[model samples]
Target: MEEKCLNIESKVVHGHSMFDPLTGAITTPIYQSATFRHPGLYETTGYDYSRLQNPTREELEKTIASLENGKHGFAFSSGMAAITTLIKLFNPGEHIILSDDLYGGTYRICEEIYKRYGLEFEYVDTSSIDNLKAAIKSNTKGAFIETPTNPMMKVTDIREASKICKESGVLLIIDNTFLTPYFQRPLELGADVVVHSATKYLGGHNDTLCGLAVVNNDELAEEIKLIHKSEGAVVSPFDCYLIIRGIKTLAVRLERHEENAKLVAEFLKNHESVDKIYYTGDTDNPYYDVMKKQSSGFGAMISFTVKKVETVEKVLKSVKLITFAESLGGVESLITYPVVQTHGAIPEEIRNAIGVTDKLLRLSVGIENVNDIISDLNQALI
Candidate 1:
């Protein structure tokens, strides 16, 4: 297929290259030196400083941009770094409405760090487009949403939300971390910007810590570039390499992850202890149709609330094969108690409003054998 016509699987696998210009290796080598030696004065190599840019990082950025169907991509040291840089794009007195139930770290920085700086944030159930439309005001400049939101797993209609934001002249930013480019490209769906906690799905393993951002327009791209350069949280060359290697198998990993998640979701649905199960692949999911419309696959992240809060720790400690961990979208089938581990930063009242109560458990279903995963969960729940 022509490069432009290539599907996501091919695009991610065969990300552009003659490999590295220095050695022409099949893999992009890490340009480890912090400073690049110039040929002379203003005449120079493509890179000047590692902080400004690096060849390995640039290659990763290009791949991410291409994957997201956007014009520019930036890699950050961590997800929070990318987000903090993004918040700088807004001035004080400007308001950005976000999904009520989102990653707690996002809530933390916005509340503790940026709120003090004058940025206004309003949390609402963005799954309801009416709620989003109602939240917009004269000062509202942006709407940030996480489809299939954290712990609760509520999905929003990205295209519809984009339309609403456009009518109001507001930017629509989607945190595409849970789904990643393999499954969904928000920029293609009319989002102004897309960001990811690449540590989760993009890295594909429990190893690397990284984040990514992509912009549809040059104006936003330029502003983000300036903030990224000024704030200096660019992903390191080695982490860039790790993420690249991980992307090479993203399509394959996600396929298996989804496969196992289907079985797992079904298992949970009939379980006595599972009070509520959240997985887009499940046909009964409230947003199942919306998820099917926008993305190719529903992904492996599943959050369920057990019948009793006391069962939370029992399940957490009982699982043998699955790990009790915080992060998601790795190759290991890890489980997390969102009330404490992930969404602890949000106040109890707010967390309870969104159903991220003490009873909820988030599962990052891995590409393990379906029977093994099910057997493990069965034992845990027992």
Candidate 2:
């Protein structure tokens, strides 16, 4: 054979290319110039401006598309920017349904910003296919979901949801942030589009901010591309370089993250202070089979409720090894209080109904030694 196919591990390590052809550099160089020069009249270099496209950013986009097994990829300045731009694909009167338990930022934008545009949003428990089917109407144009939803770890069946969406002429969009492509590929499982806060795992180090949308449909890809270029929320060439470097080690980092997370889940399960824990990897977890069927591995995020609501503040203030912070998917562990920090934008009533209460805490188990992480939690619980 002239060529051999590469596995996901190799595709990541050797993204798009092994070296830059122009300069023979190992890493893609940042094309920092905002505008490019032309050779002559009616003749133009492929890239005329950075706003439209940059060589570095283009490579990153292609890399992400390849990983997600999609036809096109668009990168934005941040995760929220990507979602906001994606909304432009629908008309003002188009209705969309979303998972009830999702990132507070997404909820805030749809309600506070996009509501006035005449787009109607229905919040439902998408973990159940019946709830999703019940919410669809004649005008329903799309369904957005976060599989193994934020804070709750509830898994949604992408294949089943895709079938329903296709039957109803609704486009299926999946926020694949938590599991990343290493663990789950939604498009491969039948999703029409996959979005990610690349800042989390694709950037890997929490050092860069990026949002990406990968689309399998040609028409959807073209529309998203138009909006991306016209709105100019594109990621910078330097940040693109950072994300490209981060993705190179994604396979190895995720392996360690999942290993530590499983151990942490076991520790919390037997702990006296914890009342209940949410882990996708748990054998008795209701959606464990769905995760097993759709994904290769359970992600590293874990959420649990404390016996006493007062313990929330104690743990938030007590952890020394694990930082009390907002963002996740970094090398260092982070403990988040969703009620106030991440999910505060969500209404209290909705928050309560979804189980993001004062007693609840979300943990992003990093690739640290399992013993150190558990010891920190053990002492913090005391």
Candidate 3:
């Protein structure tokens, strides 16, 4: 079913039923066998082995593809694995353009490993069309953007950037981990490929580590599928099952997350110890208009700065309800200091330039009562 044609809640509920009509089972079963039995030497039902392909994983892939409005979806061991596999499609010495503010792991992958293999990248302010235009080079093969970018929360104009890249014959890739398909559909906005760290929102509970890549182009999908098989980074059947189960509650969980986030953001904005709150729901936010145009919801992520590093430490240590944690997008609220937690890998100069400061804190609002979350922050700030 087309993403736009189906209700998101319905898609989440019935999109990936593993049991075919012949058996009529309620839940998808984990096909634990390593290899499927072939009828004859040359006969097959499109699956040969778990490593090459698994029935459980395929069902999950189909569900994700339907959700993201893409022709195909591939599951990987982790979000980085999905990214690495997609990048392998490009030849050595090919150039890539990326947003200046990105997940620290993405930055490290591009600078450390990709660079070592002759891949070149230029980091630019992709939130502006002019910056993207100026950054494009003859050798540029792909443009990667992270909207409401990590740590800084800078929203990129996906449609505008996709138009520019399409005209230049450059592949447009988006990291949709922050917003997820529940709030935003990058493919509908003209992105050629979308990637997510299923470890986050897609799996919701922070229990499983997985990644997914969805592509609209059939030819590109085949290439990625090939790389997935060759590289052997596919997610296991059990992880696939866990992710599929997690997705069933995505719609409801995201709604609660958004609601809680709005309340927490407002609380931080008025807090005496807070200096700034970076959230897309705030009309005064720099990327407010663009975010509104592209996403149905503003999402649950919030970044704010306290008075100083000392105060930051005090608040983190004092919080009772909100867990001081590294990863986000779980069922429980989490707090992180980006300068040392999420964006710590980036150099100090680069981190500061991208607005990842020592005083900055990120909150992943969970599906908990807003008062409990706020009360924890209140006591912590005091």
Candidate 4:
């Protein structure tokens, strides 16, 4: 239905539709049936069991694919499930290189799950192309990067990294959760595949757990699909519908999120209690130039270090409006201490090396009134 011609905002709001012909329902039905009925031995229409595929889920996948500018998209039960399926493409004893400041869950999955199976990984400061080049080995099969990386907000040069991977015969995979397709189109930046924790920004409301992986190549798309089916970490029809609803407002929500985040970062930068603020949006930030080159917006996430851990604790406890939580990219503002929360799984030595200190606070700014959010922070800091 000429989906490619539609803009991203329009696609988010009305990309795919599987409607009830009789009722003319605006929203897609759940299609909760376990399996579809076959009229004859040689059936024309493709409808199978819920495990293989669901009409509701298919619509959501297509919508996401269209939004991300990719050939295919696969939904999973959770972010980690989608990540595991992607990593499984590499055989045992193969190697993967990742950004040092990655999400703890992703680090755990690589170190604990993949390690037991003989897969190896090395964490490097991927913000520089030189660091990435130095870390590459003969066995390196993949490069998994989280630009504007978790807790630190460090931006990596995706285009340069993609070129390095291509030259080295390494697959470039990026976790586009922080910025989402609304702000950053990774495939357009030359990434082979892009993954998302739909439980975060893509879902927008923190209502359901889902993950998506969109691939630029058709073969890799099919491979991950096979791995997804074999592992059976598929998202439920109901959850897919919830995500579809959330995505309708993604563009608007992200716009507000970025605006709020910029205000918060500015507030922190001037605060006496703040030792440092790490936000890609800030012109003074080291990653700002690279971010401007790669992304349309600097995104909603911000990280900063207070004068001390005690100050961090007090600010978190004193906040009246923002919730102290682990997850980010929701409608409601969230503040988390990475050392004790998101990056807790990584060792202290490694965390410190990556600039995730005890006093560091990561804020996922929401689409709330800017003054109200700033006032809450000001009062908390005072």
Candidate 5:
């Protein structure tokens, strides 16, 4: 198939060159070295310090950029490192719009670390274009959006929001961690930048900590490169290799993840104990149509609420197959209480407004057998 016509599943396998040019190695080798020597005096081999670039890291970056349809890609030590680099791109006095239902760590860093530097953030429901438009201040430089948002599963129309951002001279930054490029390509939908906590789905097995940032334009790529280099937050060669290995199976894994999630969502929706369920796969969900229009799949993350806060504890303590823990998008199922886990850093008032209440529980439905997963949930709810 032509490169441009290749499907995402195909892209996942062949996005970057699959073999090493030097030795015909089928897998990209980890170029594990702190620095590379110049070919000769005043001549360069296109690599200097590992912090600036590495052969293994470059391959992963190029592959991610190809997968996202972006011009350039960068790798970071962690998701927060990528986010920190993004925040540094703006001046202290400028403002950025953020999703109210953002990840707790993102909120914590912005509130506790960046806010002290004179950077301002406005939390708004970006799912409603009108609310996003209203939140844009004169000094607003950009907007950070999370669709199928963390814990809440709120979906925002990236194309529509990007058009508004362009009109108002604001960059559109998307957290594409939940739905990897295999499912959604935010850059193709008009986002200027797409960031990911590759430690999640992109690292599929949950064995590595890596972050990625892809930009659609050269100027933004240059800007991020400076921050990535100067801040010394680049991903190590070995972690880059692991993330690359994870990317190879992403298509198949997500296919199973979504399939299992659909069955689980159906089970939860019918159960008497599940008072309210959040999953984009539900046709009646507020963002269902929008999600269908913008992406290929509903993703594996699901959040549901029980009738009482006490039931939440009962389910958490009772799960046998599903592990109650932090972090997600791995082969093993994880059930998290966002009120005390992922979204704990956000204040209570803000949390309640965004529906991260004590009665709510989030599930990272893994690529497990549907019946076994359902059985676990069935037993836990009792």
Candidate 6:
């Protein structure tokens, strides 16, 4: 047998092995202590407190940074906690240009929390570089993008957007939750920072809640370190272990997820009840070329609208195999109504303007037998 798995898939499984240098175990053991004993008054073992760092969490962070092609990584108690810390990088007068069709929770933070603090934000169609260019103000400090944006599945050209941010001297931050590093590495495309909701794709099992941020440079890493430590929203050692375990099988899971999603999107396209589909795997999808250029695979998430709004409730109530749930990226399938579930926090006017209407439903295509997954949807649509 090989001493280590050498490919990216293998690396994900064994690269960050915190295998006891002492015991030669395969898995990294959780260092459950809140504080560590110092060697002496002036000496240390490199760890002082769990809030600042822990060996198990460090292993996960390092693994994710390597996967994302970044120099540093930080893990948080939840995805929102990670995003909140990234926002802290800006000051009261600084501004950030973001995707208009982002996760509703992100919009809430920008509008309700950060706006009150004088941190201004402009929401625009990031798919159009011209929109991003026009939205940048003198106070703009960063551009936050959600390529393959939630629900809408909009694919922004990361390389082109990165060029704009670099020319304007602004940071480029990408939310990589939908694609995960298994299919896309945003930092490699010139993004300064990449964030993931480990609760979704990264955790892959929907059994854990965690968030991660990876930074390209040492300076931003140190700055994030301060905010993460100060906020005390560090991910638990156990949860870090869970995420690490999830990543080990990410490659296989994603392959199955994408395969199933393509079949489902095809089925939806032919069904008369379906009005439109928002999956990037289809060559006719508006973002198909850009997605092909930036990612190894189109992600599993799919959104579609029905012919009539009344049919929405019928489909939701009729699905026998796929569960109606809030989260995604698990072995089991989940379907959600973004307007009422994930995007409800966003104002109705704004949501409608962005195409998040009551007739739309988002599917988190799971790694199930494609025929069965299709069969369940076929009955539900009728």
lDDT of 1: 0.91
Off by over 4 Å in 6: 1-5
lDDT of 5 by residue, 154-192 (tens): 999999999999999998999999999989999999999
Between candidates 2 and 6, the TM-score winner: 2
TM-score of each: 0.98, 0.98, 0.97, 0.97, 0.98, 0.97
lDDT of 2 by residue, 317-372 (tens): 89999999998999889999999999999999999999999899999999989999
In model 4, which runs have C-alpha deviations exceeding 4 angstroms? Answer: 18-24, 42-44
Worst 10 residues of 3 by lDDT: 14-23
**What is the RMSD of candidate 5?**
1.0
Colliding pairs, model 1: 148-155
Clashing pairs in 5: none
Candidate 6 lDDT = 0.91
> What lDDT score is found at residue 17 in candidate 1?
54
Tens digits of per-residue lDDT for model 4 on 179-284? 9998899999999989999999999998899999899788888899788877789999999999999998999999999988888899999998899999999999
lDDT tens readout by residue for model 3, 1-382: 5455778788887765535544676577787878888989899988898889998899889899988888899999999999999788888889999899989998888888889989998999898899998888889999989997997898889999989998999999999998899889999999999999999998999899999999988899889988999889999999998999898889999999999999899999999999999999888899989988999998899999988678898998999889999888999999998888888779999988878888899999998899999999999997
TM-score, structure 6 vs. true:
0.97
How well does candidate 1 score on lDDT at residue 141? 95
lDDT of 3 at 12: 85
Error of 2 at 136 (Å): 0.9
lDDT values, one for every candidate:
0.91, 0.92, 0.89, 0.89, 0.93, 0.91
- Candidate 5 residue 359 C-alpha distance from true site, Å: 0.6
How would you encode candidate 6's per-residue C-alpha lDDT over 1-382 as one tens digit per residue? Answer: 3423355677677746546565787887888989999989989999999999998899999888888877899999999999999999999989899998999999998999989998989999999999998888889999889999988999899999999999898999999999998889999999999999999977899999999999978989999999999989999999998999889888999999999999999999989999999999998899999999999999899999999999899999999999998988888899999999999899999999999999999999999899999999999998
